[model samples]
Structure formats: structure tokens, C-alpha cells
Target: MATAAIARPQVSDAEWEARQELAACYRVFAMLGWDEMIYNHITVKVPGEDNAFLINPYGLHFSEVCASNLVKIDIDGNKLTDNPYPVNPAGFTQHSVFHRHLPDAHCVMHTHTTAGMAVSALEGGLQPINFYACNFIGQVAYHDFEGVTVRAEEGERLIANLGDKRAMFLRNHGILVMGKTLPQAFLMHWGLQRACEIQMATLSMGQPVHVPEDVVAVHQRDLSKVQIPGGPGKADFDAMVRLVDRIDTSWRN
Candidate 1:
């Protein structure tokens, strides 16, 4: 079936640019196999709008998402635009909590990747076994799964668990990553997924060699200061955007 072309939303230049970057994030999610059909969400705050943000339309695959097709909604899950597609209630409930409580969280992404889910189910969330894992030491939180996230109180619990952290493990479910910018969120997810993948692979063999706690602490501190273009998330995302454009440029619409 041929998909209809997306008409760009009438928004400010900043918002339009945010939509494009978010759309690019979705396309990259598809490219990296981070998308779990239509079950998860990657959302970015709309510039200049308090309690407003952009999220993927409910039925669209990550690959099918485009800037114009993205839906704008308030923290309460009310649609702020005249979009035909419905928003995912679970997505809103989980993401809105961070968007509303954390002033610095401009982007929030949730994923149900295999490795992430496996790690989430483990007794320990993410371990500092490698460089990627080391980056998350003392920086990850855990939330006990309470079925689907659709109730208001769940948001409260989620925020309490997340408290100032950039990443979280939704036990028996998946992972969530947040950032002050879209690029930071994407990079955080990438590093987290890699860490989970490595952890699972090593566990399959036997107990993995753990980096010394002091050395891990040092690595975390040093890594936190390592910023590249676009705030530690730019270089790789730019490369991935070009790659996805080569495959299909419709996401830019």
C-alpha cells in the first residue's frame, strides 16, 4: 500500500526543526532495530510550548513516521493539533511524567529491544562490565512493572524512580532514556542498548570480569565530560541520518 504524503504542519521554524530531528530519530530507530513495532515511543518537547511535545502517531511503524505525521499533545494527553491518528495512551503516561517534572528533559525515548528487556528482567539492572556499561554506573534507575503504564499514579511512581537520572530500566518491560536534547537521548539509548547487549552476551558464557568500582567511577566522571558536536550525540546521529536518507528520505517530510 502506498502511504499518503505528509503536509508539513504550520509551526514555527524552531518547532518545525524539532519535528524534523525527532522524525530523524524515529527513522534511525528503525534502522538500528530499536523500534518494537508500534509499541514504544520517542518524544521531543515542542519549543516554546509549556507541557507540549511531539510523539509518533499510534499506528505508524517507526519507519513510517515523518515530521508532519507526528502528533502534538499536552502532558495530560490531550491532542493540541488536528491529527487523524490517535496518540498512544501508554506512551503519553510514561513520557509525560518526565516531560512535566524534569525541566531539563527535552527528549524522552522508550524502547522494548530484546537485549534491553532481558537486562531489565535480570536481578541487577545494568552492570559495569565494559566501557558502555561503565558510562551508566550510578546513573540508571529501576521501576517495577505494573502492567501497562496508563494510570496517573504510575507517572508519579515513574518520576520518583527516575529522580535526576538520564536512563531507567522498566523491570520486566524495557528501557527508557532522556536528555535535554534529542541527540543526547538518542546517544544515551544507543549506549544503554550496547551495554545491555554486552552484558547478556557475557552472562551467557559465565560471570564477566567487572571493572574495579573506583576505576568505573573515574570512567563515569571522565565520560560525562566528553562532549562532541551537538552535545555528545551529534556526530553519530548525523552519520545515521545520512544513512537513513540514503535508504529513504520520506522521514524528512
Candidate 2:
């Protein structure tokens, strides 16, 4: 099916740049196979705007998203842009909670990958059996699955469980990660998804996976030290954007 052309809403330079970065994020997710059709969403706050943000349009695949096509909406789910696609109500319900509560979280990503959902269903979520898993040892939060997150009231509970953590495991549902920038959020989700994958693989071996608590602690500390602004994540995100362009630059449209 042919995707609709964006109406190109009037936005400032900063907001346009944000749209491009967020559109690139959607493409990267699609490239990594993390996108669950058109279900999951990655939302970023519109630069310089308090209550406005950008989100994937409903019914379009992640690969089909572009800077101009992303829908702009307010905290109350009102569309500020003339978009042909509707916003996902559940997505708004979950993301608005974070954007409103966590003032520092500029980028919020949600995914329903196989490994992520698998770990979410496990009684022991995100085991620290591997280096990737260890990075989130003391940084992960958990929210119990409460059916679909379409209710406006559920946002408060979600916020409460998330606290100030950067990553969260949505019990029996999926994963949520937030960051001060798109790069940080993307890297966080990458690490978390990999950790979940490693955990599942280690469990299938049915053998004791041993990583000393001291070692895990060291790794966690190292990871924390690298969480500086415009750090490695920014460079890596730039590289990924180049890679996506090499494959197909249509996502930049």
C-alpha cells in the first residue's frame, strides 16, 4: 500500500530537527526488527515545546514513517498537526504519563519484541547473567501488566512503578525505556533487548550461569560513568542513521 504524503505542518527549526531524529529512530527500530507492526511507539518531546510531542502515526509501519509524517499531539491527545493518521490511544496513555512526570525524559521508546516479552513474562525479570544484562542491574523498574494500557487512570500507577529509572519491564507485556535524548533511549532499548535475549538463551541451556556479584557491580558502575550527555550513544546513533540511509533513504522523506 502506498503511504500518504505528509502535509508538512509549520514547525520551528528545532522542532523539525527533532522530527527528523525521531523519524530516524523509527527507521532504526524497523531495521532492527524491533517494531511490532504498527503497535509499539517511540515518542519524543517537541524541542522547546512543553506539552507538545511527536509520535508514530497509527496504521503505518515503522519503515513508512518520516519526519514530516509524524503526528504532533498535545498531552491531552489533541492533534496539533493536520495528519491523515490517528494517534494510538494506548500509546498516548502510556507515554503521556512518562512525559508529564519525568520532565527530563525527552525520548520514550516502547517495544514488544519476542525476547522483551519473554523476559517480561518471567518471574525473575532481566537476569544479570551477561554483560549486557549487568548494565541494568540496579537501574531497571517493573510494572505489573494491567490488561492493555488504554485507561487514563493507569498512567499514574505506571509512573509510580517506573519511579526515576531509565528502563522498565512491563510485566507480561513488553519493555519501556526513556532518556534525555533519542540516542540515549535507543541505546538503552538496545542494551535491554540484548540482555533479554541473552537471559533466554542462557536459561535454555539449563545450566547455572555464574557472574559474581562483585563483577556485576563493577560493570554497573562503569556503565553509569558513561551516561554523560552527548556521549558514545550520540556517536553510535549517528552511525546507525548513516547505515539506515545507506539501506534506503526514503525514511528521510
For all the candidates, what are their Cα RMSDs to the real structure?
A: 1.4, 1.6
lDDT of 2 by residue, 1-253 (tens): 4688876678898998898899998999998999998899999999888898999999999999999999999989999988888999999999988888788889999999999999999988878788898888879999999998899999888888888788999999999999988998888999899999988889999864767889998887777575656664797788889999998887666
Which lDDT tens digits does candidate 1 get at residues 110-223? 999999999999997888897899988898999999999989898888988888788999999999999988888888999999999999999999978989999988887787
Q: After superposition, how far is residue 143 of candidate 2 from its true place, in Å?
A: 0.6
- What residue runs in model 1 are displaced by over 4 Å at the alpha carbon? 1-5, 224-226
Measure candidate 2: CA RMSD: 1.6
C-alpha RMSD (angstroms) for model 1? 1.4
How well does each candidate superpose onto the true structure, as a TM-score?
0.96, 0.95
Instruction: Quantify all predictions' global Cα lDDT against the true fold.
Output: 0.90, 0.89
- In model 2, pairs of residues that clash are none
C-alpha displacement of 147 in model 2, angstroms? Answer: 0.8
Clashes of each: 0, 0
Residue-level error in angstroms, candidate 1, position 196 = 0.3
